[model samples]
Target: MSQSPGILMMVIAFVLALGPLVFLHELGHYLAGRWFGVKAEVFSVGFGREIGGFTDKRGTRWKFGMLPLGGYVRFAGDMNPGSQPDPNWLALPAAERARTFQAKPLWQRAIIVAAGPIANFLVAIVILGAFAAAYGTITIPPVAGPIKAGTPAATAGLREGDRILSIGGREFDNFNDMAAFTSMRAGMRVEIDYVRDGQQARTETVIGQDVSKDRFGNEVRRGVLGIAAPAEIVRSTVPVWQAPIVGVERTFSLVGMMVDGLGQLIAGRVPVSELGGPMRIAKMSGESLSLGFESFVVFVALISINLGFINLLPVPMLDGGHLLFYAIEGVRRRPVEPQVMEWAFRGGLVAILALMVLVTFNDLGAFGVWRNLAGLIG
Candidate 1:
């Protein structure tokens, strides 16, 4: 695994992470619509050419599409792909109109629209917490666990149970501190300090630069000891039991950060080009796969939360956008004029498409294609 090619890793991670999350997201909307007595016509994991499909007892054609990027759920009267409604269908008998999305109670409509992203967040929280509870966290205290026999650390006479006092002569306490130092000084020479057999010892070695791509498909250089994670997993009866709570807290913390970052991007303090689209996300999924299944699962959950949060934003053309219209209708006790709604929807549609383009450009930059293109042009 240490010698695995970086490119191959990026490819696998992208699919594993995004594919399931998307399907689950669509499922949320599908289930909610059903709950509200709105039947689904089609449930697809992607758009366009059909890879595979089946008609369920309910007559819903469930299938996987060719693109494998984005997905959608088509409701019974969703003549429009967006599932808002068709006015011509609404012009039919009152009973027919009742089945339409717009005709449903405002609360039900809101739930159906909000369901997609909500599922994403729930999946993330459960997956992360369950994983932590299942696999007791590893406490990589400064103590030596196992050093690869042929690695530099092993050759330097380091032994099991030796407590690492410092690396690169800088005092370090836990794995986090060591990681911080190693990252800042990857591929550089350093001296390791450890207490072995109750005696302090120092060994000189150079940290290896791991030329790897992160889950996001961005090239990252990190310090490596050419060692594998140890088998000494700590089972914290008390701490492990609280994994769910901690996991939710952690997820919320991340959400807060993303919200802050998006706020900055909107404020123009952060570059819109820094926003990543699906391309970058898939690439990242591939990279995360290389780290290990645990790490990959954690990332998958995070992406789910991100999907949930992103969809909740009150922007048109999105699930949240429909909810916005519903809110406006509720406030005024009537639907906004069709012409006015169309204009606003179009404006929002343009904004979303523009943002998509910007993010795709960022994804290209993240994958280093932008740099390659720049070099070629020059």
Candidate 2:
């Protein structure tokens, strides 16, 4: 069926977003592998035959391909570009097989597989740091700024200095996230968990209109409980001694959150619709950029971390899949049967492809493509 301009924009935006993200992710693998004396034979930005490329000094043929969906790094002795070991590699001299991935120490192998996602997280941190250094940080503490005496919040017993803990079941880390939530809807009643006098607290708030005329000469309506945040960050940055600590902690926490989110998704507590494909990400980045360069960079960083986390999930035909085999070998003292592993990998490819289709459509619907198409048709 024919679509609308909005739908087309979303598609274009999505491809643009995914292209770089996928390329960088695979680049991480390529660089890290090469650094460790592992030979990367090919570095492809996308799948299928090479559309454009040049050979590097180490015989690594770097190329761009027709498909922008995915990419791979082909290591020496690999069965394919993804670093899977070849039978011929095993048949070679013991010294030769020693250079293959299957011959590497489990620790080294894990590091190589992990480097891809690690690169993503690193990208996020650098982007965030650069943005933070440039634009400074924003701080919105939970302490209520002020509630107009005649407003519903004041009348409803909401008071200033009340520390917000959670809203709509999501824990509020700071006032910034709270503000983001509040800005989404107007006149929505919400149960807010908070702290009163540094003790346990609970609140039910009926959001009222915080009326204002927006910059576009239009009345912009948004949810407001008449809360205000202090406009400052104190310029928080990792000290030289603490950079790694803070970065690692943040990375760990993000991983935990991603895992928790996945668990919730699998349990049906959170819908798969919450998942964002390239289209959603691009739209988000564009919006964030409109807000500020810092916001755009930070959003990209966050997306990079998300990309890293998802790729590392223990699914067959993924880096995690190879790690899984190594893990099994460590425990059982033998590699998984080649035939079984091959079949499992085939299934994995199928699963991954199916998921891509679902997410793409989800992205279209998310951007309201169908509605726009309907409007066009009408």
> Candidate 1's residue-wise lDDT over 1-378, tens digit each?
123336666666777788899999999999998888887878999888999999999889999999887899987666553454675875678876666666678889889988999899889878877876786545556667777776666767777777788886677555544664555454567788888788988887777656775334445655666444444545464266698786786578668767755764566544456578987776666656766788788889889988888888888777888888889989999877777767777888899899888888888887678799899999
**Residue pairs clashing, model 2:** none
Provide the lowest-lDDT 10-residue window in model 1: 229-238
Give candidate 2's whole-model lDDT: 0.69
Candidate 1: give the clashing pairs.
Answer: 9-286, 10-286, 10-287, 13-285, 13-286, 14-285, 14-286, 215-284, 216-284
Candidate 2: where are CA atoms >4 Å away?
A: 1-20, 80-84, 145-158, 165-173, 177-194, 197-257, 285-293, 372-378
Clashes of each: 9, 0
In order, candidate lDDTs are 0.75, 0.69
TM-score of 2: 0.74
The most accurate candidate by TM-score is: 2
RMSD of candidates 1 onward, in order: 9.2, 5.8
